[model samples]
Target chain A: MGRFHRHTDGTVHEHEHPDVRHDVGDHTGYRESGTVRVEVLENLLAENDRVAAANRLDLERAGVRCVNLMSSPGAGKTTLLRRTITALSGTLQLGVLEGDIATSLDADELASLGAPVSLVNTSAGFGGECHLDAVMVRSGLGRLALSDLDLLVVENVGNLVCPAEFDVGEDARAMVYAVTEGEEKPLKYPVMFRAADVIVVNKVDLLPHLDFRMDRFLGHLRDVNPHARVIHASARTGEGVDEWCAWLLHVHGTPTQRG
Target chain B: MCQAIVDTVTAHASGRQVRRVTVRIGHLRQVVPDSLSFAWEVLTEGTELAGSELVVEHVPAVVECAACGERTTLDWPVLVCAACGAVDVRLVSGEEFQIASMDVAEEVP
Candidate 1:
């Protein structure tokens, strides 16, 4: 007899195969083919894309432009977000969906800025995915008041590899690369750099103390993403914050430019 | 990732035990095939797909340029056209992550 077990989650598993004597022409007066081939041309991420479509519709209906921000750990993505929020909060409404492997520290920090913030901790479930896929972003959307905000930014989990794979219904994709991370990052993590619509080179204040070559970095970046707008900024010093804000406003189609 | 693979196998094979699965992943998808295979071995221990082979095929990234009508394969992410240097290029492929086919041991009814 075939041994079968059902888990509480409703997944069925066949534990052991049943032994039976079978002749070639025993069943239905035809020979049994023990092996079969089935063609299934279906994308594994299709389900996630379906949810992402719904998320896109929701954001569109609310007139909220969402940006998915990705980068490696300690790249100052949160700091750049804080500076962006502080620079534009006076003229534009903003909301944040902070993604992390664990802890609500980033969300808590953004919340201090008085902007509506929601936390999506992948570690709670979803196997602590290093990237924020569309399904996760859809779930995070439910926690935010989309109608109250003109723009929503999803700070993806700090990783360069997997984050670029999943699309989270974002109007734009941006990434921050800190100077301290070195210049060869563009080639090492080409997918992340290539997927980004905007690339911000952060921590320019420390460039004088480091051996980072801007030319090599830009060369690699241009080779990977020829169309991405490059911006240099120092979140700590507030340098290039206005230019970045202007670019954001321009891309968002908002007429108001920061004075 | 294993869950998705298991679901696909179960849906296609039904009561049959899966023998092997072939998946086509694109360059831009960022999935490490070795890691996926390792995870599959661990996750399918008690399932019907146990001992099944996981085969991965990588697809190259291709982009079609609107200006020059050039379709070229890109090793990296150069969105611009090589001929005319136009940035008006649309991605033709390289984002795929799909189960192309499966081999299963069919039960003789």
Candidate 2:
């Protein structure tokens, strides 16, 4: 049985039920259960790592920077991608792979920005899969030639949880959050934050009109990810979008051209 | 336990809980079975596969002699065997990430 416990130190731990033992054996004899813990000489993620490395190598060889964009529903992922396309279109031609449970709405939004976008619908036949895999993304890439694009942004299904686990050959994985979400998000869900390289707190133009506390949100974000850069902006008013785009160009597109 | 590792990782895993986790290590991979199991338990503490168990297997590499057709299993990456000083040896298997089947539990309709 799995039992959850909170110690006085406030650290939470789940306990494993010890296997049953036999008392029929002598001091040095054999036992029925709780056998010696076998040393597992296995790298659990061994398979995925190989595929991820290959994906990265392919991206580098093609000179295409792949970025995985993750967020919750209505966290402004497509909106952010649209703004990113418009902002970086001058120097960096962008492509988008929009993963959704259903519909082409997100893909449509991206195409309206004049960006080459592909929508991967994983509605039912995918066995209720929540996130996109490298193989799936690779197949999507096959339809587009990398020579024409500088950046390929994968707007993963609007989920803060599962997308953190799978890698889609992106040079980096970034998380998106909005002011409407509570500050406790990072604490309530840490897996996504742990995997993020950048954190975009969108819809910040509503900060003055909402109960969002910038200090609290920053503290929580820092607690989970101390190194990830956070950009506060309104995808609507394009407030800090320029700075965000500048950072992206520095990391993925063209940096030396910046003034 | 494999289940524990699966459970702890399932929350983070988007596709499926890994069914069979295989590992490959070189003598120089500096990976110890105990340490690996310890890391697995520590990492798999509180996920969807808490109750599952682990299967650990070792892959001993075979190196071929450049001068002679000698096949040796006790070969290291720096295989300057005491028998032959030939620095050219083709390896047959025995690399890391031997993880084979992920074997996610089939979803019921």
Q: Which candidate leads the pack in lDDT?
A: 1
- Residue-level lDDT of model 1, residues B1-109, one tens digit each, is 6678878777767676678899999877768899999988998889878889999989988888999899888776556666677778888898889998776665454
User: What does candidate 1 score on TM?
Assistant: 0.85
* Model 1 superposed RMSD (Cα): 6.7
TM-score for candidate 2 (chain B): 0.63
Lowest summed-lDDT stretch of 10 residues in model 1 chain A?
Answer: A9-18
Tell me how candidate 1 scores on lDDT: 0.83
Listed in order, the DockQ scores are 0.52, 0.05
Give a tens-digit lDDT track for model 2, residues A1-259: 6454443434233323344434554634222222222123345454555677787788789898988989999998877887888888778888898888889988898899888887787774664457886756776777777778888888898887768767778888888899899898887666688578888899988887898899998878775566788988889998888877877776684864454
Instruction: Give Cα-based local distance difference scores for all models.
Output: 0.83, 0.68
Task: For model 1, state the Cα shift of residue B88 in Å.
Answer: 6.9
